[model samples]
Target: MDQRPAISASQAGDGVTLAASGNWTVTEAERLNGEIRQAARLPSGTRRVTIDLSGIDRFDTAGAWLIHRTARNMVNDGLEVVYTGIGPSREILIGEVEKSDRPPAEPRREAPFVTALVNDTGEAVIQSGRDLVQLSSLLGSTVLIMAGFLFRPWRMRLTSITYHLEYMGLRAVPIIALISFLIGGIVEQQGAYQLRYFGAEILSIDLAGILVLRELGVLLTSIMIAGRSGSAITAELGSMKMREEIDALRTLALDPVEVLIVPRLIALVIALPLLTFVANMSALAGAGLTAWIYIDVTPQTFLPYLQNAVALNTFLVGLIKAPFMALVIGMIACLEGMQVKGSAESLGRQTTAAVVKAIFMVIVLDGLFAMFFAAIDY
Candidate 1:
């Protein structure tokens, strides 16, 4: 016959003895739990509890847990609890359950508002420090790698550089030109409307020329490259890192920085200046067209005004910043790529971070350059 799970409690002189028996596997856990609960309601004046499990025929973790729980409850009720006649197998099971059963944890005390704020601020400061250190390290390593290539120019990956030049520069020309053209038209329209208030609508050519040449042209191109090519570089390197291809390169005694990063960096340095030049011309073309249509300013007149407004230095200033911005974008992208962990989610996060950081740094660098050039009277 299948013995029903049961627990019986009896009052002693100063304690209660709880006896448990019968099948106590998971199949009988429900009935066993009910009996355990019932046995926990000890008689009055019970100052101690004893559990006798010698009668159990089948015992598993579930059964042992019930027995352990009953004893714990009685102890919580200010009674000393002891187990007697526990069989060898059941004692081992009970021991395992006892190892896991722990008293409820105390509630955590909330920190003061000021304390939390200080802690968060400290963490942010530390994180920023770490990021700066990592970026500096990447820059140093890349410089060293470039030095190595200078000694062995034959080691430079021309094919890879050419591929990236085509991918990031040539293929990107249309969109770059298109966006620049549209922005130029908008600038000229706004400049003409605003300048007409002062009877200087013709100065719109100066406004369009100087702005596009000295700032907007290269700045917007850098931002586009950061968003497009920077993200692509980060995503590509991140995927390779995740798939152990980078590690494989290391095993082959090949430097990943040389094979992967240097070529991309070189390509960016070369491509960005050329792309910036193209964008500047496109933007000027657009502004010229806008001037001719909106204000009836002839291209002949507008060209002369642009030529008079902007000096060689104005164009040179923007072109000079292009390679520097490219270096920043490429380095930041490659840095973020190398930081990626072994997960698709990590790759996506690094790629996003690469784009955001590159754009922000580009703008910051532009502002610094503006200040420096203004100081130097460039």
Candidate 2:
């Protein structure tokens, strides 16, 4: 037999004393139980027990489970089990409850690089062709929509043209100017290096003029308008789609496609060429400034050289590309916007897609123009 603590019963106050401090074992379970049972036998009016596991260092789960059970039993017997200087040394009774509650997640992996590249390229081409067909159809529909205008000549289409032009054209000029100037400076520098090798630096002016006129002038304008105006159009139309406002118009016997999309497409096709002309002029001025600074070539000398940089075909080439790019931007915006699913997040994603797709198409168009120009023996 081993020593068990005795609870001193009293009329006024009664308490139990623990003999040692740290580290007890389940082998000592029966000994602890006898002490606790004795503490419970104290008078109800004077019931309180203090446990001190401050000694006997080193314990295991067996000891902790035993303590828990004793504490429960003491509390049930109207004895207060004050755990003093007691750290939970081996508390492991609630094992599977905690384990089952936390469901483990699967780790994620990226797709293989080659397969990913193939999938992405295929998707982009298919999506581009789809957008092109949609643009052509929208163009035909917009022209056909003018048939409604013959009846009500001052209709919504007319208003939309004015509104979209004001929005996309006038407001977009300053930034377009800045971007063109920077592009001209960069192009002049690139051309200067090559032209300098032959002491033909003055030809950099002609080179800048040709690039700005034939490529960056129209290309930069289209890219800027796509990100700015095209994104806005997509977001606006996507919002309307989300709110079912487009459908509500259909319920009123109105064609949402003609009223909304047609004017925007027409406005873009009409506006981009004028915007490109402005960009071309601005870039040429910037290139001339660069030439003046580096090569000591004055605009009077530069302007005459620039005048013969290309034939009439170069001037007309940008105009042709402009309408196509504008049409691409507008149709892409409207199509993606209309395709937006629920939630504002989808609208934002579609707007981004529209802008990116439009810019990519503008670049591709420029490459085609380069090929076409080269083939023409220019």
Candidate 3:
């Protein structure tokens, strides 16, 4: 026999009485649903409803929810609703469903364009201030740690520093050299091409020499390191953080700032200046080669023109910026790493943020250095 649920309703005066029978489990849900709809279509003049469940043979949470929903809907339609024959257990279930039921959240209305723009701008300004404060805190911590290391050099993790140097510096040299070389070649070729219009192709050597020494070489090196090494630093530290290794270090009375971050920071501070010097050499070599091959300018003539074009301050300006940029990149990477939450998604997010923020800060530091040097006429 098909165990379908049934509903019978009777109308008297201005009241409707509904009797529910048979199984009201999910198997009979379709039938119960149809019966409920039919019972709801009472006489238009009806103002009260009473639902009786005494004849119901079976009931579940689903059936109870449906009953509760029907009663609530009747109340919403301006009818006085009454439910009867619900046992203690079924009544508790129904009560739970009623308590848990909530209307869907309303969609938010968007503000006007001008209002939204102003709001967003204010939020951005506030966020930038918070970021500046965090960065400054990290900087102060790093400086204090480094100063302490000077007194207790043995506390510095030499092995970790060497490993990071190999990971971040040695592995990075080829790409840095290749990119800087190509950039240098392109700049020289363009300079030669433009100079040819004025019959001054020899001036290409001077242009390439001055540009690479004062700006392009170290700048490109710092940007590359920020993207490459900074992301790796964040991923490593973030993974450790996510796995609670950083917390473990703290529990063991080991300072993570000194044990982990300081090594990487020292490696970057030492490595970046060396890498920048190598980049400068590679760039000059590429420029010289390009001038010889493309513009028929020989090494001998190029050397004389380069020496005459760039002063000692030009080389020092780029080299001096390398350590500061390195410090910024390393600090941002470590700061973001320490911010990672306990999830792979958080680790990935922090890693990406580290790279992006490090690169941005590196560029910003370069600009500030440029302005300061210009102000001092260095």
Which candidate has the highest lDDT of all? 1
* Clashes found in each candidate (C-alpha, N, C closer than 3 A): 0, 5, 0
Model 2 residue 167 CA deviation in Å: 0.7
lDDT of 1 at 290: 98
- Per-residue lDDT over 1-378 for candidate 2, one digit per residue giving the tens place of the 0 to 100 score: 233323232242466644333345566666755665564455445466665555536555555555565556678776776756565433233232224435477776778999899999999899878877876777677778767777877675677788999889988889998889888987897798788999888778777877788888998999999999999999999999999999999999999888788888878888899899989888888888888887787878887888877667767777778998887788889888888888989998999899988898889878987898789865
Where model 3 places Cα greater than 4 Å from the true spot, the runs are: 1-28, 35-61, 77-79, 82-106, 342-352
Return the lDDT, model 1, position 284.
Answer: 98
Colliding residue pairs in candidate 2: 21-53, 21-54, 21-55, 22-54, 22-55
> Between 1 and 3, whose lDDT is larger?
1
Candidate 3 achieves a global lDDT of 0.89
Q: State which candidate has the highest TM-score.
A: 3
Among all windows of 10 consecutive residues in model 3, the one with the lowest summed lDDT is: 1-10
Q: Residue 181 of model 2: what lDDT? A: 86
Model 2 has how many clashing residue pairs?
Answer: 5
Summarize candidate 1's per-residue lDDT along 1-378 as a digit string, tens digits: 647778888887987888877888899898778878877887777788888887788888888888887777776777898888896777888888989998788999989999999999999899778888988887888899889887888988889999999999999999999999999999999999999999999988899999999999999999999999999999999999999999999999999988999899999999999999999999999999999999998888888888899999999999999999999999999999999999989999999999998999999999999999999999
